[model samples]
Target: MRKILVVEDEDAIREVVALNLRLAGYEVTEAASAEQALAVFSPSAGFDVAVLDIMLPGMNGFSLCETIRRDSASIGIIMLSAKTLETDKIKGLSIGADDYMTKPFSVSELLARVEALVRRVGRQGASSAAPEPDGRMVSGVFVLDQKSRVLYKNGTPIDLTQVEFQIMELFFANPGVALVREKILEGVWGENYFGDVKIVDVNIRRLRMKIEDEPSAPKHILTVWGYGYRWNA
Candidate 1:
């Protein structure tokens, strides 16, 4: 059974969420605080998804979500909160929360959201019945294999998280063109309604650390002044 970690401060809500997840045939773990959630959702974590509540006591769900994202990429994250403002939703999704739900939500709806996220993650891989074709695009020593989600520099594999892979895909698809921060977010994050552009900077820094010889003087992925970023292709 796939495991799910539920992080909610309210006892009643936490128990109810746990009960529903368990009923859905998942091994459920409960954490009432951000500190506890971190202890449970590390890189060597057991859970497959995290159902996190946004209104926690100390660290709050947003901070916890960022912490978890920094640790692992395979796990799904769904943020639950009573805050229905668009900004709140944007904040949650911008930091790598997979799905956001407003409070007073139905158990069935949450279950469906979880299922959808898991299914979407699975589809990123090429199926045996419909294998992805081989193609390569090279920029100096760095090479990208789109079908297999692999990046190689001089024949050695470069480790990229799923988000990084998507960013590279965007750059490859639109070579030599400036991709605005919002456009990259929409294409890569599945929703760019959020206003913050710093997330783009953070991911680009990560990509450079892996692919560029001198990140400060990037050759392939270049920054366009007052605009966005571009790939030399």
Candidate 2:
């Protein structure tokens, strides 16, 4: 069974989510605050995913997400928030979250999102263990090592969140192809994602900050006006 850490301040929300996750066959660990969650979390805990609420009693979700990410690169993170603003969503993704869900969300949809993230983590773990036939993809000064899930620019490592890495992989896989916003959402976030397509836009901006010498004048990942984005190289 996949282990999941759920951190929510509200007792009711925590109980409901934990109960449902257990029903769905996940080994659920619940915490009422970030401190409590951190107390029990360790590399050996073997958690596959973390579900964090943005509004917490202390040490807000974003900070907690960063802490968890600092501990484990392969574990998936999903942020829950009552905020509907695009900036808030972007902030969550910008930090390290693989996925974000606004409050008043359907439990079914949340479950699906969790499952998708778990599957993605599993796939990446497997890929890391297996050697790729085509080991590396090079575009301009950027190099993506598919087997290790690492990106390099000018032979130097570039830090990228899991979500950003996946987006980059998609662009590298289909160079010169214009990938629509919806296509990016489906590819990176999953087909069951019910969030805004703007998530793609946010991630694209983040990618530019890392890959482009000047984010305002991105040469590699270009906008296609009405269509979407295309990888020039």
Candidate 3:
């Protein structure tokens, strides 16, 4: 059975979210704040997903999300924020969230995202070894291990979120393909994904920050003006 951690301070909101998730057949653990969330968190606890509210008592959700992401790359993270600012959403994604939702969001949509993220995270942990010939692919200074779902630059491992790794997989597979944003969205987030297309750009920016020496003038992931992005190996 899949397990979920829902962290929200408001009693009504937390109860509603938890009840809905439970009705959907997911075993959920509830936490009122960041501290409570941490107390319930265990690296060995095998939590498949965490829903964090951006505003929380003491440690904020951003801080908690970072800590959880840093600890386990395979665990799926979704951030909840009432703030509708683009920057806030970007900040959540930049820090490590796989998805972000605004308040009054559809319960159905959140459940769908959680399900999609579970599949993604499952893919990363599907295999343990890569003895296959095509399991490892090299693109310029970076080597992406498909089996391990990890990227290394000059032999040093680079941390990647589940979505980021999938994006890298697509990019490395087609080094100079000049894939359009829609293609990227389909490849990474699937055809039925319910979200804005600009998420591709946000993730691409995050990748540049990690893999490129200068993110402002990226040497690898190049923009194609009005088209999309092409991986420059």
Candidate 4:
């Protein structure tokens, strides 16, 4: 069974989510606060996913997400927020979350999203081998190492969030392909995702900042004028 860490300050919500996750066959670990969650979390514990609420006492969810990300790059993170603003979701993705969901969300949808995230993580864990003979893809000055899940710009490593890494991997895997917004959404955020497409645009901008010397005029991962984005390299 896949292990899941659920951190929510609201007792009712935490219990409900944990019960449902347990019913769905996940080994659920619950924490009422970020401090408690960290106490239970160890690098060797092997948690497959983390479900964190944005409005937590003491340490906020974004900070906790970043902390966990620093320890494990491969674990899936889903940020839960009561705010519906696009900026809030973008902030979650910008940190390290692989997916985001707002409050008043359906239990069925939550379960489906969790399952999807687990499956995606599983695929990444299974395919850690080099995608190319050299285990890296060189396009222009950017080099992407599949095994390390790291991007290099002229031999210098560029830090990327989990979502950013997945987006880069997709672009490298299908060079010269014009991926539409919906396609990119399904590719990075999983098919069960029902959030705003603007999230994709937000991430694209973030990716450009890291990979493009001039983010204002990106050469790779170009915008295709109302259609979508295409990877030039």
| Best candidate, lDDT | 3
Once fitted onto the true fold, the runs of candidate 2 whose alpha carbons sit more than 4 angstroms away are 125-134
Enumerate residue pairs that collide in model 3.
none
**Model 4 residue 152 lDDT score:** 94
Q: Model 4 — TM-score against the truth?
A: 0.88
Please, what is the TM-score per model? Answer: 0.63, 0.89, 0.92, 0.88
Candidate 1 has which clashing residue pairs, if any?
Answer: none
lDDT tens digits by residue: candidate 3, 20-112: 989988999999999999998987989999999999999999999999988888788999999999999989888888889999899889989
Evaluation by TM-score, superior candidate among 2 and 4: 2
lDDT of 1 at 169: 70
Tell me the deviation in Å of residue 172 in model 1: 6.7
Model 4's C-alpha root-mean-square deviation from the true structure amounts to 2.6
Q: What is the C-alpha lDDT of each candidate?
A: 0.77, 0.85, 0.87, 0.85
For model 3, the stretches where C-alpha displacement exceeds 4 angstroms are 125-134
Model 1 lDDT-worst window of ten: 125-134
- Candidate 4: what lDDT? 0.85
Clashing pairs in 2: none
Alpha-carbon RMSD of each model: 5.8, 2.8, 2.6, 2.6
The Cα RMSD of model 2 versus the native structure comes to 2.8
